[model samples]
Target chain A: SQQGEEDPQALSIQEGENATMNCSYKTSINNLQWYRQNSGRGLVHLILIRSNEREKHSGRLRVTLDTSKKSSSLLITASRAADTASYFCATEGPTDSWGKLQFGAGTQVVVTP
Target chain B: DVKVTQSSRYLVKRTGEKVFLECVQDMDHENMFWYRQDPGLGLRLIYFSYDVKMKEKGDIPEGYSVSREKKERFSLILESASTNQTSMYLCASSLWAGRPNEQFFGPGTRLTVL
Candidate 1:
């Protein structure tokens, strides 16, 4: 079953603009991680935010996690045409066995030049 | 660099035939996983192994089985392929279980069942 759900199923923005997406999960999680996938390819790990951490930053990617609300948001600053891809939010619940992750349907982002 | 590889990038099989999808990781990670991705369903775990010869069922295990005979290799087997089983299959490996470690994924194999 999918534990997380991403809002704004699709988003389109011009290059240099910022893109933001939100993900909400059902249960308490040990960690929330974001992944990016190009068309017809595997996913690449983007950033990870632990349950205890409120926010984290890697390059232009910023992730915020709010356990109280069971939600997380990912922000991409200065988007580029090359940044166009599908982003997914995965949650590893505290009770989840063997590091399994429940992934959301994902949000497709398109950046136009 | 950590690397994971799948046996095929594309495969076509007939329904009711036995199918095998292979995955190997060079990182020597103790944990490996198999997931199937559909159009709207992001990804669903079919099976996972924490160590050689140890397997565990994931959320959707029906019509699928797995093998991890060697530490670096994991294989997902379909006893009798069905049209619904046609999807993008992904293989991933991580350092350990119950950790904050990230998983490394292969390019994925798109299987078509007729």
Candidate 2:
């Protein structure tokens, strides 16, 4: 079963604009991670934020996690045409098994030039 | 560099035929997983293996079985393919055992059952 649900199934924006996507999960999680997948390709790890952390940043990407609400948001600044892809939010549930990750439905972002 | 490779990028198989999807990871990770992605369902786990010859059922394991004969290779098998099984299949691997473990994914195999 999927623990997370991402909002805004699709988003389109011009290059150089900012893109933001949100995700909500049903149960408590140990950590939340973001991933990006190009068309017909494998997913690439973007960033990971632990439950104790509220905000994290890497380059143009920013991730914020709110444990109280069981939600997380990913923000991409200065989007480019190359940034067009599907973004997924995966959560590690509170279980002994560490490698198990439940992913959301994903948000597809199209960056037009 | 960590690399995960799938046997095929696209495959077409007839209904009721047996199908095999192979995945190999070069990073020697101890954990491997198989997932199927559909339009609205996102990604659903099919099976996973934590060690050689050790397999565990995932959320959607009814139509799929897995084999992990070696540490680097994990294979997903469809006993009898069906039209409803057409979807994108993904393989992933991770080094650790618990939460926050980052996974490396392979280029998915798009399967079509006709």
Candidate 3:
């Protein structure tokens, strides 16, 4: 079963605009991670926010985790055409071992130049 | 940088044929994983190994099997390929899996079963 579910099946935006995506999970998690995948390519890890952390920033990417609501949000600032890709949210539940993650369906983001 | 490479970027096989997908990690990670991606289904874990000669089943492991002979190499096998098995297969590796860690993934193999 999928532990995480990302909102907005798809998004389209112009360059320089910010892109925000939301993800909600069912169970308690140790950490939540975000990944990016280009067309026909494997996924790349973007950032991970622990359950204790409420917000994290990496370059133009910002992640916010609301454990109370079992949800997380990823925000990309000043998006570029290169940022066009599918974004996925994965959760590492406390009951899961060996860092196993359950991924969501993902959100497709299109940044038009 | 951690590098994960799959044996093939694409493969085509007939139904009932045995298929092997190989993955190698240069980072000497202790954990390796196999997943299949399909349209609207996202990536689903098929199997994962934390050490050599050890394996664990994921949510969807009925149609797939995995072998990890060495710490850096993992192989995913399809006993009898079916048309419905055609999808994108991905391999990944990570270190110190006691907690959540970033996974490094191969380019992925697009397999087609006829």
Candidate 3 on A1-113: residue-level lDDT in tens? 88899998899999999999999999999999999999999999999999999999999999999999999999999999999999999999889888798999999999999
For residues A1-113, could you state the per-residue lDDT of candidate 2 as single tens digits? 98889989999999999999999998988899999999989999999999999999999999999999999999999999999999999999778374899999999999999
| Candidate 3, B57-77: lDDT as tens digits | 998999889999888999999
* B61-85 per-residue lDDT for model 1 (tens digits): 9999999999999999999999999
Instruction: Name the candidate that leads on lDDT.
Output: 3
How far does residue A29 in candidate 2 sit from its true spot (Å)? 0.5
* lDDT (0 to 1) per candidate: 0.94, 0.94, 0.95
Error of 2 at B93 (Å): 0.3
> What TM-score would every model get versus the actual structure?
0.99, 0.98, 0.99
DockQ of candidate 3 is 0.81
Q: How many steric overlaps are in each model, in order?
A: 0, 3, 0
Interface RMSD (Å), every candidate: 0.9, 1.2, 0.8
Ranking by lDDT: 3, 1, 2
- B43-114 in candidate 2: lDDT tens per residue? 899999999999989899998899999999999999999999999999999997844678899999999999
> What docking grade does candidate 1 earn?
medium
